[model samples]
Target: MDVNGFQVLPSQVESVRLIFKRHPDIAVEFRAKNQHLRNACMDFLLSLIETMCQSLEDLSNEDLVEADIALTYLKDAGFKVDWLEKKLDIVKDKKEKEQSSLARLQEMEDSLLKLKQHCSDLDALVEKEHEELSDTRTPMSFDDVV
Candidate 1:
């Protein structure tokens, strides 16, 4: 079957399913590891966003002291901004790696489809040869041929 322009071989699907079934515990272990990384990145970004929002609110408040404090808060916000920018760069790199993996998987799927087509062609050729061979058999009377 085709999935998003990639042909999914029956053998590949079976192998993936077998791997998942045989390594359920390991699967969750890896997933937990990834979730931890993702959560940390998200938390960092959220904290940065919250800080920016609070700074904006403070700057807009009627109190002159709060507006003055917002200036100092803006300076403190710079570190979080830089950290978030670096984290975003890491995310971009991860996305690029994922795209490369998908492309490789698609190439392998295309190769498998070509292999299946060749096998099908070979099977048809063999069937045709068998039919032709059967057609060439000479008819014989039992006594006359003997």
Candidate 2:
């Protein structure tokens, strides 16, 4: 879904979900923007990587060097190259509950159909019994009919 012009592909979302499932300990926060400040930092770093200190650029040499070391440490600690979690507004538990509710509705419908059929059968039987009773009644003499 496109939220604020950020198109979230279903496959990408599923991949992120699978990654989270695999690494349950990892916690993710969905924010309107990148809270870690990596996006801007990465852009600076990418420019530096391509230019190799030839361009003075935005970041100073010392800051760039420090950032490189920090990134190395982060990578060593297994915290690098992770996906950002966005607020997709999906709830698995809610979906499951809806499915169960639909199943219950289907069962109720089946029961109602059965009840209607049974009532129909009872009415037919009553009608037949009344007809038989009428047939079994014997005619009486005109004086005795009263």
The TM-score values for the models, in the order shown, are 0.40, 0.37
lDDT of 1 at 83: 38
lDDT of 1 by residue, 14-79 (tens): 533443354333223222234444334333433443443453224222433442344334334332
The C-alpha lDDT values of all candidates are 0.47, 0.47
Query: How would you encode candidate 2's per-residue C-alpha lDDT over 4-51 as one tens digit per residue?
Result: 222345544454455446654332222225533433333332333333
Against the true structure, whose TM-score is highest? 1
- Candidate 1 matches the true fold with a TM-score of 0.40
Pairs of residues clashing in candidate 2: none
RMSD of each: 23.2, 19.3
- Model 1: residues >4 Å from true position, as ranges? 1-44, 47-77, 81-86, 137-146
